[model samples]
Target: MEEMIKLNSDISVFLYDVLTKRQEKNAKYSLRAFARDLGISPGRVSELLHGRRLPGRDLILRIADALKLSPLETEGLFRLVHRQKLVQKENGGARQLLADEYAMVADLECYGLLMLMETEGFKSDIEWIARRLNVTALRVQSILERLERLNLIRSRYGVYERLQHRVTSTHDTPSDVLKESHANVMKHAMEALYNVDLNLRDITSITIPADPDKLSQAKEEIRLFRRKMAKIMGSGKTREVYNLNIQLVPITK
Candidate 1:
């Protein structure tokens, strides 16, 4: 009956809120029902609520889905539960590095899953998403779950919405996740070059020879162009999903 608690950084506290909300909606909703939804045992759910055990990454994601949390709330749940997992590993006298490795590895996802949610005529239907993204329906279903678990999208009354936009991956400190994002986009671009109509896709390139010292200025110019194009793109109604790649590659490197 109270305002939903704003999540910051505590899994036990979050679970408590979930339990309370479930009971409020149905006075008969018991811990066993919560466990059934989470795919965990009732005793285990109680342990989580009581802070006697830390939730595994898989379990935490299941919990998020069971709670039907909004995207932002799901992200907070992930960050908090991940922190708790690390603390749990450390408290067991195990090296914290292992848990930290798990945390880092778990942070990545293929970009397509989230990007497709932004396309025109976006729907929560698995088959629609599969056709739009040119992926298998089964893969689309997996992607939907991944996006929901990562809190990148939310499903409310069977309608899905993207909560965040514009992903930036720094070349300064490369990551496997970042590399994978670029790889997925590049593959799609390659497909467009061969399969898409000339008018439907724009593929262009330029060659410039200049002093290496001006690389910073060149980067700034590219940034400005990207923003300008984004502004132009936003002026019209979005009819379809599009990918824009501004690649600056060295011919001599």
Candidate 2:
């Protein structure tokens, strides 16, 4: 239990630092090589650093032994291992929790429900939310429950609050899940284009011939614009949910 109290607090940072330092010393050090040295699969190391998986006791000890950790680091590693056990016992481990959230996001209505929860006129009533979002009240209730379980949203006095306001996806999100989400969002946008009033919707697109080399810089520009929009929208005056999708693809053959 002493180890549990003295844990590293963030194993992701520790493993990333170790990988970086080792790469500095060994020019040819790849993620595969790093994982081999630590006696684990490259995929496992990737997942650990990405905050998708947690290591068990034996694997943690083996990693420490292979890294030839300092005495203090060994203590810290043991603590990390013990902490993982406790988290697993209490929350069914990181993978299970992430999987549940991923599955939740797979449902487009659930995704819309989260965004709708942020509107100033947000309603805690499932029937209201379902009617507003064009989904069933039962589904709205179920999605709210799932969101609460995943800690993505919290409830107090029956009002739902978004726990994580930053809208971002995991680095290692499944491709199919992302694709399906994109498809659903596209369908919604198409429907809105015809149904929503011009004063309430903004949809514009341009087709231009562009150099491929400049596309990377264009992407950076979009990223910066999105970040700026997020900050501007953070002023506590949010009254509506909007989707801003930027697309850059080849059209010239």
Tens digits of per-residue lDDT for model 2 on 1-253? Answer: 2342243344654676577667779868888998898888999987776556667777777887887776677777777656655655554343232333575667668767887887778888888998887888888888888876555666656888774443344445678877887888788889989999999988899888788999889998998897688678756888766776666779777
What are the runs in model 1 whose C-alpha is more than 4 Å off?
1-113, 166-174
- Sequence-dependent TM-score of model 1: 0.56
Poorest stretch of ten by lDDT in candidate 2: 1-10
Where model 2 places Cα greater than 4 Å from the true spot, the runs are 1-100, 233-236
Candidate 2 versus the native: TM-score?
0.59
C-alpha lDDT (0 to 100) for residue 153 of candidate 1: 49
lDDT by candidate, in order shown: 0.62, 0.70
RMSD of 2: 14.8
